[model samples]
Target: MKSELEKREILLESGTNEVEIIEFYLGGQSFGINVHKLREIVPYEPEAMTSLPESGPSMKGMLLLRGKTVPLVDLGSHLRKRQVENSVERKVVLVCEFNREVNSFLVDGVNQIHRISWKDVKPLDDFFTPYKPRFTGCITVDGREVMIVDLEHVITEIFPEQTIFGEGEVEGAEEADAFKRGSRQEVKILVAEDSNIIRNQIVSILKSSGYEQVTSFVNGEECWNGLNMLKAEAAHKGQDLREYADLLISDIEMPSMDGLTLCKKIKTDPVMKELTVIMFSSLINEQLAHKCQEVGADGHISKPQIHALVKMLDEYCLK
Candidate 1:
């Protein structure tokens, strides 16, 4: 029987159900945030705020919501170099629990919700050299282009002094118990990530989930080559290609060919099209999720709650 996680993966890749969405406008473009992170859309009243000193040019000010003060960041200023000029249409978008923190974004205006397919979005390359805050991915809504904001990236950038890496240790003895009890028959996961630390963290998490076999690659090109090689080997050995790789997990931004290109290659190739693929990215956006769907990805996940990842895997891969 397919695991629950595998079932969800199957449902996602096969184009089965409805997904949540949030619509907004920026730089004359209309975009949407995943309903997962969207908390609520509130009217922006300039009078209901307190400014934080030394919070940089983009940090507009703070709002006292129900007695607690929350910082409201200017989304346009951070991502597209556009400012949230004083206007009646602008509103504060409350993004729930990014990096485990409650945050709000200031936008030019709020648009209606878009019932977009998981397959219609794509991630935009950070052609912006050093990259900017709030930039995650982009998609088209009602014939207008909109950028999906990376709430996690934005929160991390704003609070650089705080360390979000909790009790960081990899494949340590502490996880052995979980590995023994929860793991299925060892499954192989092909992981492609650019950063060594992040890669190691992902590896450790997968291992803890009972995925005994994992092949880690630094970039999408290598991952593609590796998968092809594995496929060839499996054919030679008369083994099933599905047995070699239970899933493919990757990061979007990499050195050579990005994750989107890799996903496109894998999905287009008949030899590997059935392989379950999930994109695990720090860059959160509906546009990237849409692109993943376009190229035939199984699903998309944010690196917000690392622990929640295990639950995701269990729900999608191990049932």
Candidate 2:
């Protein structure tokens, strides 16, 4: 097993930057998935036997590859229409990996790979609206718009029960010894974010701040699961449920359930009604904060603000 230091080094080497994508057409619009996550593209052969149930509609069905059975969803249907019309030249199945699990989706046609940087991506206002939106942002490819979908969100949406991490605690327990002795009170924090990059950074920041007992989750569903686990453990110990996680920090957008909805649910639940919930995200504005407040969030913080995050942790969580 690699030590914590070694693992951290490897993650640092994989810098977050431009993602190479395989662009494809669905519903006459273009979409892109990270080439790093895509394994291959197979032509949609009519002779291929599909094992998907007649009632199953989101993903068309399953395809046999080698000895493994992979579920295939109609990419076009996921975007808009249900009955997808495919031509011989356009019909193709996109084989991609999600959460280390390989799955396939049928697309109308494939386009050439285009290298787009993170700086070129811009957020979609449609996603912030009440209506369900798929893509996180749009990247302009040769004057045309290409939608960038959040892969983590889509996968977790399909499989809510899948655990993001195991029960084994993170290593480097000794590295946190210095934090325990510090005069600063340990902060009780719960983070619900879908992105790995942001989650790791926030966790790192909190750990460095002498804060212990931090709990994290990828989406709202996982947050609920964690809360239930914490509650059950507390009951077993005969401890107050409020003595568990101190504060709730969540992103605005997520899959399986959004942060806004999660905050409302937490506040409405009789057992967890008093926890402090904050909406921490890059999408920030006075109007958005007001919207978060409406959803029962105690406060809001803009993203990439490490200093602000530390300060907030001290104020709300440390107190």
Candidate 3:
């Protein structure tokens, strides 16, 4: 039988701005995760997990599945909440793949999947502190709001060394710096990412890499509005939109409007189509990459590839 992820991937057509999320529970709170990230769901077996020495509180240990060892993270512990007493009896592990890494999260129980438009999802940054790491957005399903987990952020916190901008991970930083300093000061890049942490990190990395003229928005709708303002300004000055912005770097899964929808809108527009569009997202895979190409995106890069992103900017924008 096809896994839920595979089935959903096949059912979801590209550029539709829709997502299927797997709703789950942890500490009596509802949570959601994009189905594309899920590899499979398995019943939790205490014997299957081997505890690691000196592991963090949330690091439940490693699980051996099909000759592969995957780390297990306790979702309840990470949220700093006490799970229900009978959680273990109904526990399940959500095995997910992102940024070419596989990990599993232990949750209290699994609920039904939901298919909803990206517009229904709302950014949580406006209501929460910038430091909150667990949730990226919220969506109302069946009269209740389900908070979506920022799985990438959780994994990054667990393994800090895996960060893309960490020292020694960025190749050709000097060259990228030189390009930015020498002739790319006027190149404006617009970034759209819903997660405040990821968005700030990306902006910081870009500025540190010497790309100073960068503007950021919390979601695709904001980005679209920003682009329109730039268009209006450019038109008033009798200049092209490219004069105001050279490229757009967008996250795939965002509230109000998705990156693919944003890219499609840009490509479909007469003037906006001239600007280069790069899908910078953790959701990038063979299927999603094809979607980017279909929407006329100039390129696609997986999340946490700060070095490669700078290199691309140097080669494409600076040149």
Candidate 4:
């Protein structure tokens, strides 16, 4: 069978608001990751892996691939679920990239790819509230449900130092501090991010930086509904939506409705069109940057760049 990553690339346009997911199995449960993040799929070779000392349990070890040493993460172990027995020799490894860093995830097997609309993927927040559910969203494929793995969160958990506000991560600490002191504390900001850890971190960062009036939602759908409610209230009070929420910072890979779709909707709507929308995501590459622009996003920032996000907020919202 063709490896999941070996399938023909789906020719999705820049701003069509669609994604291709590579489904795989771990501990008998179907899970998926975005195809765009995948580099390739390789057969797992335990003999080829070099064990690391003093690493996390999920950090299986490192594997040399194409002249580079890549860390290997056991997906099942990382999820704290039943481990995929190494005795079963025919295991699969998925090589993926995020925030310009590459890593591999070990899984039981690879399934075929599926192209789906962001609308089909439902956020876990609709069902429950947990710190980290391991999976960001769930999708139904041919009567079977598949959970989308929160790969970025997984990697961050393994390497906490990669977090946005980790030590020595602030690019312009002086300027950021100045902006926070000089900025208006009354600026209402709406943040839409599915990852609970990231959402809370962003909220905390914004609050500490003087953005006191901040509201957060888990996904674009929730954010959109919240915006609609605010719009209704603004209309009833004969005030602009900006008076209620001046800016929106959203992740691009959210479920129900992605950030690009949200930006497009906000920009096209008469009431919310003027609201400043910033695309904040790990998937913000050159092509994705163009997509953000095509969807009417006012600004774009790559992930794990808290300082840059702050700078953008100051430039667009504080000014």
Please count the clashing residue pairs in each candidate, in the order shown. 10, 1, 0, 0
RMSD of each: 8.8, 15.9, 2.2, 3.4
Highest TM-score against the true fold, candidate: 3
Q: Candidates 2 and 3: which is better by lDDT?
A: 3
- Which sequence of candidate numbers ranks them by lDDT, best first? 3, 4, 1, 2
The deviation in Å at residue 221 for candidate 3 is 0.6
**Which candidate number maximizes lDDT?**
3
What is the per-residue lDDT of model 1 for residues 1-319, given as tens digits with 9 covering 90 to 100?
Answer: 1143223333433222234346776666565665546545667778878888878876888877778778888777776545435543455555454443567788777655554543455556658435533444566765666666556666667676533345543333245475543554466678998656568867876666566687899777789889989999999999989878978888765545567678888888888988888888755565446767787887887764555555555556664
**Which parts of model 1 have CA positions greater than 4 angstroms off?**
1-20, 46-48, 83-90, 132-134, 161-187, 192-213, 216-236, 240-243, 246-319
Cα-lDDT of candidate 1: 0.65
Worst 10 residues of 4 by lDDT: 1-10
Q: Which ranges in model 4 have alpha carbons more than 4 Å from their true place? A: 1-10, 13-17, 45-48, 80-89, 123-132, 167-180
What are the models' TM-scores?
A: 0.56, 0.49, 0.92, 0.85
Kindly state the number of residue pairs that clash in model 2.
Answer: 1
Q: Which of the predicted structures, 1 or 4, would earn the higher lDDT when compared with the native? A: 4
| Candidate 4 TM-score versus the reference | 0.85
Model 4: residue 67 alpha-carbon error in angstroms:
1.4
